[model samples]
Target: MKKLAVIAVLILLAMPSNGLFNFHRKAIHFNVSHEKYVPPFLFWRWNERNVVIEYFDIVRNNDSIAANITAYLAIPPSLPNQEIMDIEFEPEPDKILEDEYGQKVACYKLKLAPNESLEIGWRIQAKIYNIRYILLPFLVGDYIPPDIKEKYTRDGEMYKIHDPYIQQIVRSIAANETNLLIKAIKLHDYVIRHLSYALDNKWDDAPTVLKRGNGSCSEYCFAYIALCRAAGIPAKYKGGTYLAELPPYNDSIFHRMVLIYLPNYGWIPVDMTFDEWIFHHYAFGFHSNRFFALMTGGGASQYLNWTYNSHYESVAKLDIDSTARWLEWK
Candidate 1:
């Protein structure tokens, strides 16, 4: 009887409890580096112009990883009476590293373009170190509450709970018969119009922006994410490097931008502050090519959180491709 009781206790201990006892943690290390080599070119005052950009990137990691990288460039549009040029994509060299597990880690290389043919001259080389950990908390649905359990049953109001801003936005949309795309556009526009871009201010938190109505690129992104998530739009935060044209005497370092996930388009880059600044000031229209995006979302306690560091040194080399030609519009 005693032997049987001991065996039963051991079996009970082996079994997972509410799916929480079966969870595991994983550790990964990753590194990404970029370099650009651009040949000098002249700019002409035509309705449309064609230019080719070239880029090279190298990434290294101790483990396998998967991530998305975005490269932005200003391309001339093809419109009525506009000349269009075909953009080309060329392959670049990729470097790989192996781990002790003897498993070949995954690596991804992508060339994100503004349009299909107009390939921006940029290369994003990524190295990923991934380890799969079984999370027991998901087995018995221990992570979710009983009330919220029924909410996830369907994709309606029950599932979309506790977001005041989203509720308000949805109400407005329903009243006006507006679609989701239009709502996102209008919401972004509203954010841009209401907020001002001021790099001098140091606050990058969402609550700070909500109270002060001012923030930097991160704040802009946080505010945007909060509003989007509140609307049940499934939004996330993206932080990475950007290339911006610096003035001759200006010593500003690093550029930042925001990316939101669109249902049909996956992730789309939006530079609300840049667009607003250009629309209002017109003096700064060009972004740098050496800016490299590093991380996404806010919970980056493990990796280096570049967005929070106001004085982080930039590893970008800016070379002026053309002479300054300021345009004045009424």
Candidate 2:
């Protein structure tokens, strides 16, 4: 009897749950919406690598007077595409505060004597993920959240979205385009074709770029973003240092790009300058992990976009020198 019972138990364990001992076993069926569908083949296609960024600023009191300096250093934030693994400061900031955009601002206050200098900076270790979303133009829905549109499309300091000239340009370029993705691409191409790459000392704004017909990388980004926003496409600024292994490192050399929000794909990077310069052909709707993105939104300050913010009050002349550079960390 015992032997027969053991054999029965073994048979029960070996049998499929639905075949013999089925108890509350239910079949599961996943109904994925087309808007949020990710193909199985592309689901796991993500590459990750680490990079290090060193941003430093030097404040020198040149005149025969003392000065009080308040420096607000921008610390890179963790985003969906990149993660801050670790951070180290040269001599630790006096205090750290979070800006409205969730970017960390390290505040340093110092009293520098005449001919004295102060250097403040931070080294950030970040892991950047190269995850390219295969965007199907037909699959991109045209619905943006009301709040997103309200926040991104509104007129800001440099982004003159509601300006008459900007509206006219938007109408001419993307007015007839129904697909949001297609409209964005048209605007990107228009900026690339309309503007010439030239470094200017004047104000960097959308209308100025359109009128002058020449601007640097930041101008290209501004022009494209303004057009997109005017056409009711939510877009924002992305500022960072391009990580390249050539010509050494210089603090003054940084890059700017634009990120437009797609209904299904979220934020997609659009690099018109890169496309124009042939650094990355067909760069729209695609972004590589070759740069360190420091800031995502703009218009928080009058003279600063996505970089560090500094304010100093002194009775003497102050000369501030800043440098930002990055390299891949092994």
* Candidate 1 per-residue C-alpha lDDT over 1-330 given as tens digits, one digit per residue, 9 for 90 to 100: 353344334433432353223324212122211212211211111111122222322222212232223222222222111222442223321322222211111222433222212122232232111111111111111122333223212222212323454456545543353343344455666667778866764645554564577777766766665555555344444344332333121113334554443332223345667667654211111222233333333322222232321111112221212111111101
- On a 0 to 100 scale, what is the lDDT of residue 111 in model 2? 90
- Quote the positional error of residue 287 for candidate 2 in Å: 2.2
Best by lDDT: 2
lDDT by candidate, in order shown: 0.35, 0.68
Candidate 2 global CA lDDT score: 0.68
Candidate No. with top TM-score: 2
Give model 2's TM-score versus the native structure. Answer: 0.79
What is the total number of backbone clashes in candidate 1? 17
Pull out the clashing pairs in model 2.
251-324
